[model samples]
Target: MKHIRMILINGPKRVGKTTNANLVADMIGRSLPDGCRAHRINMADRLKTLTNSIYNVRTPDGQIAPPDYLEAIKDQPLEIFGGASFRQALIYVSEVVIKPRHGKTVFGKWFLDTVNQVCKPGDVVITADTGFASEIVPIINQVGGDNALLVRIHGMDASFDGDSRSYVHWKHVLTFKDDTNAPFRIGDASVRPDVLARGGFREIDVTNELGFPERSAQAVLDYAARANWLVRPTEVDLELAKGPTL
Candidate 1:
């Protein structure tokens, strides 16, 4: 164990997750030595080229399956395609067969590999995080789970702060329609707080008390202190907090 703290930022789109992530990273970095600082990696950019590469794929029976068709057939009975014929197809469909096909590619092992290679213990690694915990947490444990923290930034929902909106009483998810015929995804309120509560992780509600930028930064530092990370905000951290230039 290298004694590193990795802050995995989780939240829905348009919910100020990246902004808060940068602030937390800067605050953590400021607590470290002058030359060292927290490292924030936006995973989408790192995996772009690999995700874009085109691969010509043929199933076991020499039948070529396009990306869509490969995914469409994953859970169907093998009897339809013939057991032996589909078996080979299954092996070749990397995109379709990986991690039960979430909204996009799960990026599971490969993403974790990149994170492991780039970050070590004692360093602050904050990622625009995705991929389910099942695929990522085990690898993190290989280093040290004690040093890791998963921060789930729930979208700002002021209603939840009011007594009228208890967790059980309220359930509203925002959905988005794709203009270009892309997949229709829930946008406004898809992230569930209960699921994030698992794994004993800390929760920061951007909905109330810390919805604004400055408050969000303070909330993070406060949480770190409460958790015993012992962050003493320095001049550099103050400067970093002024704006997200870095």
Candidate 2:
């Protein structure tokens, strides 16, 4: 049977998850056999599309506005679209509208379907936007425990500090209030805590104090190797296998 390696990189926003994921993907691509490839997919791809549509903005080529454009206009008033700032509007649509109607795992299911349809055998698929347990659990179930790895990046400026009012929670759409001790809940369940409690997948906690430099990438690669997701030939083994120079 053909096997696909799926790596889900989970962490607070702006903490170099995407950088690390790309690094891991490049490493895996270099190590893969001929005809195999590595791909990086974002879980928020569809959400971003929906948000663009809500904003009713399009590129000159008629495509939806890209993320950079969206980021630039995130603070624009949505009075015509009937909301607050574009950023808050996206949060409202995602948390209060779509998720409540379609279920929390809707995006995860869509992502899994995309992977099954587009990914080939021996492909290494990585996503750096994982946040909720509702999303990760279903994807892990589809990929199987042995084939999936959940990497949690830590030590960044926005790292979660167990405070409901922390910037990490705010980035994830959690509301901030005077009582910072309250649990960070997105609906009924606590956000980060729920994700941490999920099992059935191999996990590596990467301390990315220096962002995704050579050292941090190597740290992630080492953890992946220990998790059995990567099998790299040692230098001594390669040297011994080499025949004497003719």
Candidate 3:
């Protein structure tokens, strides 16, 4: 079998990336290669959860906790005075945590080391979050090395009647042609470049169910089996041959 390592599950919030990834991971029995793992990049929420767990506890030193107790609890400490809880959990093979560091930090060598340490040969590292906003492709390029696969899941509801009485924003619904190169706006600024750079393999039409649940999950599995990312050369190779774009 081809060494299929690294899979990215990208999508809008609450669109079932996590749920689907879990289902798929279970379905394939041996879906995950040895040393391979799955994770959710909810750094803020995760940090809060971790902080809350050991938040107000008095240290063994019999003194009050330190000021940076929160930072000391992350899965991986990106900074000097980082946490150790996350680092400990990540020592195992099946641990899901959030991704810290934005921008170049996302592709930093330390970040790669953490992943490489947890990930082994034939491993499939998965990220089920809105990480598609920035360096999606470059991140994938960096992670997958040469034989990795990247898949993005899109959660959309297309049943807008454009009624003035509708509760949801009917005008924001995507149209037929709008699927291609649609502008993703975040607040006043446009985060389109980040999303587009990572791009998507196949856009799942989740309009009917509005929550891919199992279909989207199965689609990702099936797509990985036959997706171009699995066969395409390394991201650097593609960039060298096609020109540096993302």
Candidate 4:
């Protein structure tokens, strides 16, 4: 059977996990042979789709808006839902309703199903929004440990100051809590150090210091070098090739 590489990006809120995923996808797409490209998928996509359906709302083009758009208008009260903001509604449906009914691995199962259907041989599938271990363990198991890469992004400037997202408090939730000592802590949440300890899976740590573009580019370069893929010369290389500026 043809194999695909799966990159799972894990990090706190607003730390550019999605940015890195997209950058890695683009980089892989350029390096891979013709007819094979990278694909970006979010673990929360199923949640967003369910949220949109429950609210009976669709984008202007008759499609559901992604979670980021919902987050942008998260505080806007929904009249039909008794003034609950989009964020509140999503939390209710996901945590309170779905998990209680369908189990915690429901989203994970859906994600795996999607990956099985859509991902082909030689494709690099990257996901930026991997929060809980429950959501990704099955993926690692399915894709086999050797084919998966877990990238943990650390944003030096990131803070939990005013953020009230459910994920921020996940470490405290009984079902999601990890008993093992975490390697790092982001706000109140542990950064899934347990998941990182799994054998046979390659792990990468990216410190987001030079902002998204530079850091993401650096990440892709690192990944390419590690994966033995053809490394494309970056802008820095081009500048260096011309010698130092006076």
Candidate 5:
């Protein structure tokens, strides 16, 4: 239970998640106390190296199993290699077979370890958000409990549903909406609206309110700062935002 003030900037793709994250980090560094540090957990950079290995049994014709085709040759048998040989191969693949892991090489526990290092007692940690907001909520709990706070900057998109989208959604979600009795659950964990409000967590509907064009990162950050979060800029940051020097 270290006291950490964490802000999770989440939303759909092209929603300015990164821009807001960076701005928030910069603001925290300037606005907070002298010793406070504003750090960004760039998940994309870290997770781009994830291992995505597949155990494929190339057929005699050179046609491999379709990627992500997970119909096990169990229960009712199908064609192809068939019988005992297929069963043995499947067992070997399941047990001793080693395949390349796709996506980020390190996940779950490893991610938490990295985050813990970036965080301090009074620092503001802005997670470089991914589409996996719901899925990673548990990881946040594991890393920062009463000490950390989660804020999701929402974007309007019909395709942002957890199931349909590539960004896998988890059952346990702690959401911030204008809902009464809306206790969002993350895995087995849950957070109520009142709790979030008390903990300095709130939501902003950027799609309608903010006149953000498609995929503009900077616009998203501006919207968040104006609406809910305050991003205090440093001299360097302000210069960067204004554009590079000649």
Candidate 6:
């Protein structure tokens, strides 16, 4: 089997996760071989489509019906469901039932089974999103171990970025209150942490290369300059023709 490689870009919100992911994708694309190509897959988009509005759902007749909607999912048994007592049982149900299902699309059985629907071997898939790394990383290690590259982007400077990169602004309902008792909150929220204790990967500080004095120093440029080492050579015989190593 071809050694499949997946570059997982992970970081907290407002940390330029998406922008930096695109930059990495561009660098990889520019340097890739003919048959080898790089593509960026935003798991956030796929996730929203997979999980229908599980929280704050409304009845067709216009009645608030979050709990009624969660009634169906409450049956699925998730042990982690009991740890944190959420203000809204409905939201909790969605957490345990809906979000965990993303693993099927992320890096395991369902991912391999349906990968051809979007990707193939020799394809470098750069993915970005927020979920439980502890749970997701294990599955990735189990299935794609050597083929996966987990990238943790850290130390954000959103001020100079001149834009709102946080998903809280876009995906969140802003004024969401699951019920009268539930606190008004942002989104069906989560954070992507930098520590992946088990996965062997790269940690890039997206901000370290940016800003006034260091304008020319960029993470993408640095990676692009050295990426050739990471890419498999398209031809070995041609290289062997030159010389042999000691």
Q: In terms of lDDT, which candidate is strongest? A: 4
How does candidate 1 score on lDDT?
0.46
Model 3 lDDT per residue over 1-246, tens place: 124344545444434555655554444323443444443332123333343344343457765444234433443443432454433333221122223212221322233444555545555555443232232334333433334344445445422132111111111111101112213211212223433354433333321135225555555556665654233212122112222111
Score each candidate by Cα lDDT: 0.46, 0.61, 0.37, 0.61, 0.43, 0.41
Task: Per model, state how many residue pairs clash.
Answer: 5, 0, 4, 0, 15, 0
> Which digits, one per residue and each the tens of the lDDT, describe model 4 over residues 98-152?
7665555556667877888887887778888776665654565455555777677
Compute each candidate's TM-score over C-alphas: 0.53, 0.70, 0.42, 0.70, 0.47, 0.48
Better of 5 and 6 by lDDT: 5
lDDT of 4 at 79: 83
Give the per-residue lDDT digits (tens) of candidate 5, residues 52-85: 1233445456655442232234223434335433
**Reference-based lDDT, residue 62, model 1:** 64
Better of 4 and 5 by lDDT: 4
Candidate 6 positional error at 102, Å = 9.1
The digit string of per-residue lDDT tens for model 6 on 115-153 reads: 445666666767665333432333343333345545555
Badly placed stretches (over 4 Å) of model 2 are: 71-86, 160-200, 231-246
Compared with the true structure, the alpha-carbon lDDT of candidate 5 equals: 0.43
lDDT of 6 at 28: 60
Distance from true location, Cα of 68 in model 3, Å = 19
Candidate 5: regions farther than 4 A off = 51-108, 143-149, 154-171, 174-246
Question: Lowest lDDT 10-mer window, candidate 3?
Answer: 168-177
Q: Which of candidates 1 and 2 is the stronger one according to lDDT?
A: 2
For residue 78, give model 1's deviation from the true position in Å: 34
TM-score of 6: 0.48
